[model samples]
Target: MKSEDIQIRDPFVLPIPEEGKYYLFGSTDRNIWGPGTGFDAYVSADLAEWAGPFPVFRPPADFFADTNFWAPEVYARGGRYYMFATFRRKDNDLLGTAVLAADQPLGPFLPHSGGPVTPESWSSLDGSLFEDEAGEPWMAFCHEWQQIGDGEVCAVRLGADLREATGEPVTLFRASEAPWATPYVSPRYPDTANYVTDGPYLFRGDSGALYMLWASFIDNTYALGVARSASGGIAGPWHHQPEALYRNDGGHGMVFRAFDGRLLLTIHAPNRTPDERPLFLEIEERDGRIALAGRTSE
Candidate 1:
């Protein structure tokens, strides 16, 4: 499949060294006409030609299907690949993040836990995992502004089994708290400043500086930014830089090393609501910070 042939938001690619191929996963929809369905995974060897839309996951028989299925990211850990994704519940009108497990990257994934890592009562989404220096697991997720008014990013310790939350989730920062984040003002909510919090992925810099790449709107345009953890840990006093990492109305980014050992960031640019394409850019670490090195044709 060509890049435009694949319709997805928050595209994540996991390169399997043993197979010499990449597994791609994201939201696959029929049209921009209704709520999102489940996700699909595709395999590619050269990042140009794709092989399978191999059914990685779909709503189970009689499963909750009306609400959105958004931002599915796969991570390989401890001999198993795990998928962290966002799902909303129609029965209670609540949103949360859940974990799925599989033996392979392009998987017939199975729900490992009963539900989300965040509490059922909280309206949360975009949950991602991070491992600290001591090899401790942590989940950082967003508390939706639709329910809280000001969206927030929260973190909590994950149990060893990766099935349950070890403790309560702590508020890390609000969407409005970042110096670079702007409020979305539309006629829908005219009186107040509406905030949004989207994807959050953790990366430990080569210099041991911990950072987070998250998405939000700046002047109602989609953008991605990076924040540094002062303590070099997940539970830290994070400080947001004054500028965004990518500001092309695109976001929901993840950092990975290319097959050739160069650092790369993958995100969808020109972030139209329903139709978006995966874009990869070369990135470099300079002075313990990340920046756009260039764009790659690959």
Candidate 2:
């Protein structure tokens, strides 16, 4: 679809080879009025034009929170599709990530777990699941900076069934530790700087180099940054890249391969809350690092 035609943030596309179609999903908000009715998916053979805004998920009648249903990422694993998404609780004013399951990419996904994965007391969101080499699942999530001055990315082991977290979440890295990460600047906090980390995507390269693409703001512009797992595993001794993967006013990136064997990085740029659209960029790996090879719109 044309970039302007699709209204979404945190754009996620899943290619179904069997159906010969690609499904695109994201957070769709008409305006600042309130949360969108539900999550929708669009199908396409080519990325330029889309078919339908098919409803994949909607809040249940007894759903907890109506607002702040954000960042839905669908992953196909072990014959089922699982969605990791964030929701805000009405009672406590806390945000947490929860898992939902369905049989297909465009799903009528329903909650699979009993409740939120992050602890009830702490404010967390944007939870992404990563499976390590040993086939054990792990959740890489963000601890919101609003609750704490410095936002943190953490990892915790997922239960064998992928329904719950097994132990206390371990701190992987703080947003401020990365050279490319910048803090949220506001007149409210004139003296103190608070870092914000949103979205964490983990993928292992064909060459066996482990990499993660995450989002943060830099100099008031949304940007994407990368970090490498030096131990060649998801549970890293990760090394932050000296430079970010993309620094334009865009972020929240994910990597997927085209049918033609080319690696592509998909992210939205010019990221304003009400004006974000999907953009795809060709990518290549060199010297154990990934970089933008070309822009599709070029």
lDDT of each: 0.81, 0.83
Locate the minimum summed-lDDT window of 10 residues in model 1: 289-298
True-structure lDDT of candidate 2: 0.83
User: Over the stretch 1-298, how does candidate 1's per-residue lDDT look in tens digits?
Assistant: 8776777788888888888888888766644235755778888876778886888877666554357787788989999989988877666768888888989787778787677777889888888888888888899999998788788999999887789898999988888878778997757677888888888888876777988988988888899988888988787798987788888788888888778887778888767856688887877766766788852111
> What is candidate 2's TM-score against the reference?
0.94
Least accurate stretch of 10 residues (summed lDDT) in model 2? 289-298
Backbone clashes in model 1: 0
With a 3 Å backbone cut-off (N, CA, C), the pairs that clash in candidate 2 are: 1-47, 1-48
What lDDT is reached at residue 96 by model 1?
Answer: 81
| Tens-digit lDDT track of model 2 for 146-237 | 88989898888889777899999988889999998888885667678988888888987779799998888888678898889999886788
